[model samples]
Target: MENRQTEQAYSLYKPLLFSLAYRMLGSVMDAEDVVQEAFFTLYKSGSDHIHNMKAYMCKIVTNRCLELLRSTSKQREVYVGTWLPEPLVTTASDETDPMQSYLQKESVTTAYLLLLQQLSYVERAVFLLREAMQYDYDEIADIVGKSSANCRQIFHRAKRSLSVKGVSDTSDRSDLEKATNLVEQFMHALTTGDAARLMKFLSIDAVLLADGGGKVKALTQPLHGHLSISESISSVLKKWPGSFTCRIAMVNGLPGIVVYKDTIMWSVFSFMIRDGRITNLYFVVNPDKLTHVQ
Candidate 1:
């Protein structure tokens, strides 16, 4: 009966726990592993004495992520090329999966996750719990084992840091529509090999960062300015002799492009739009990172 009850509890909270873990760690495999470990710990300890299973599970996952982050700090510092979070690819129509549902939320977008990466683990936990999960300061304190006042301070500090980066929690519908339309135009330009058309949609100061993890050929440094990026894209396309299929897909809850070569995911392009032009373009081509796309 206890085992059965624990299984039931796992089903009830797995989605929320996985969501929290993924947001905290920014790695799908690590998030899934942490979630499973949390539940296994819960099952072994039994849930009878637990007053709030959801909070308990969140605490476990958050603390585990903090530990993992600390251990991986050196790895990130030494990471080859530009580093990007593993892309959480989703079909535009698959709404039933809990992980998909959580990922579709703005908090899990690659851009937002990168901002969160700017924070310390404690600050990230407090800010995410307070901002993304909508937890109260007191609740956040409990999860992160900080005093309520300290959690409040951490949250404010984190918010201010993101503000310095021009982060906004709110999304405008018109802006979203414009972004989607721009992505469509960008894809069309890419397929048609129209360099001028492609350049038209990019911001003058646009930046492009590609992460290949040194496992594949990729830009070793960011490309700046519209003309540079435009020419780079044109040059790469010209070099390809074999035909590849490209399609606009919803990547990290925004309209993006996915390219497939020999039916395998070759690259994912996500953009950040500002003032009606693409301000930032993230190209993820590391094969290890594409393993989870399907």
Candidate 2:
């Protein structure tokens, strides 16, 4: 293919390919690297004989992500504390399809990505392709180099492993408004050190998971129950100087907060809000993971 054609192809498919790899690998940096490698492969090999560029690019990116998955298994196994997906700061575009927007939200969530860790690489690939990407069984099989029947089985197994209801429509205006208000209140209580107010918004079974990646001071284990979570937050507030600030912002397409000490980002807090209460709180303090947050 000519240079102009390759550039057009890259511009057209990069977002789709990056989204696929990010969902598969759960790391923005890794996803970018994998997508770049896919484009490099295409550039070097030329796309003259490839009739369908999208399918070819998808296959290449999926295979590259699988390779990274196998290589990073040990690293993830040795990662310190609770691991969370890298939070992405994304805004929905007006031209995006409704179904695609919903799927994107479902796939990028910390809860959903953490569940994906249980599946094998191929199983995860098949599941994401079939569910998030809306690929048919035959198309998924072609991408993963498996029979259509095998792909279907893998996808079903993945679903059973998740064992959850379908992804809900999170764009509901009422829910969004409620979540935003709760998030604001939660942040206010945290910054002001009002444990009583903060605890009110937390569910009785609220859980807090912090990821420090062994490079920062963070909880070495998951904090469980509302009391534990509240105490943990309170303790941190007491120890932390008043200079640190928390600002409400979008994280992984949901209401969240970004923490900053002075001018530098210190951490990010993403919550799972259900019925006007915070169910799960994910604190990603690992500096490595916060690089993309700003």
Candidate 3:
């Protein structure tokens, strides 16, 4: 009976647990592994001594993520080119908690996740627990093995490290609609090999970062400035065999493009728009990262 109850609890909390781990580690496989390890530890320990199951599970997962961060820090140092979080195919209905739903929209963004990479493991835990999961300072302190006061200080420091000015609601329908239209125009230009049209949609200071994980053919360095990015896009189009299909999809809670060759996803392109122009373009062609996109 106890085992059955634990299994049921795991099923109920798996989505939240996975979300927390993914936000922490930025890899679906690692997050799933950490979640499984947490459950395994729970099953081995039994639940008789646990009073607050949710808090206990969260603490377990958070610690596991810290372990992963410590272990993987060196590997990321040697990663080729820019590193990007694995693109997740997210839907509004996946989250049951309204607050979590909102946080999911804001925190899973590629830019925000990149900023999180700058934080130390403890600072990351404190910030994510407080801001994304809505845990109180006391709860965060318990999870991170810090005092409530220390947790508050860490959260403030993490915010300063990321230089977060304000929270923008990316889920706003008007903003999404505008982004979708802009993405459409951008895609048309790229597909049609219209460099001038493509350049028009990009901000003057636009940058394009490609992640191939050293396993695929991609730019070894980031392309900066609209002219440079335009030339790169034009070069790719000129040599293209015209075998892929591109469509706009919701990537990281924003309008983005997915390229498909037959049934396999070939690449993902996410954009950052400001003042009706794309300020940044993230092109992810890394197969290892795209496994979860489908």
What candidate 1 gets wrong by more than 4 Å, as runs, is: 164-175
**Candidate 3 regions off by >4 Å?**
91-106, 166-169
Number of the candidate with higher TM-score, 2 or 3? 2
lDDT at 229, model 3:
94
Q: How accurate is candidate 3 locally (lDDT)?
A: 0.82
**TM-scores for every predicted model:** 0.91, 0.92, 0.89
lDDT of each: 0.83, 0.82, 0.82
**Candidate 1 structure, TM-score to reference:** 0.91
Instruction: List model 2 lDDT by residue over 120-229, tens digit each.
Output: 99999998898887999989988999999999999999988985464332467788778889999999998977677779999999889999999999998888888878
Among all windows of 10 consecutive residues in model 2, the one with the lowest summed lDDT is 91-100
Ranking 1 against 3 by lDDT, winner: 1
- Note the residue pairs that clash in candidate 1: none
Query: Can you write out model 1's per-residue Cα lDDT over 113-165, one digit (the tens) per residue?
Result: 78878898899889888887788888888999989999999999998888435
**Candidate with maximal lDDT:** 1
Model 2 TM-score?
Answer: 0.92
Please provide, for model 3 over 9-113, each residue's C-alpha lDDT reduced to its tens digit, 9 standing for 90 to 100.
787778778878888988878888999999999889899898988889999999999998888889889998789888755544555754346545556777777
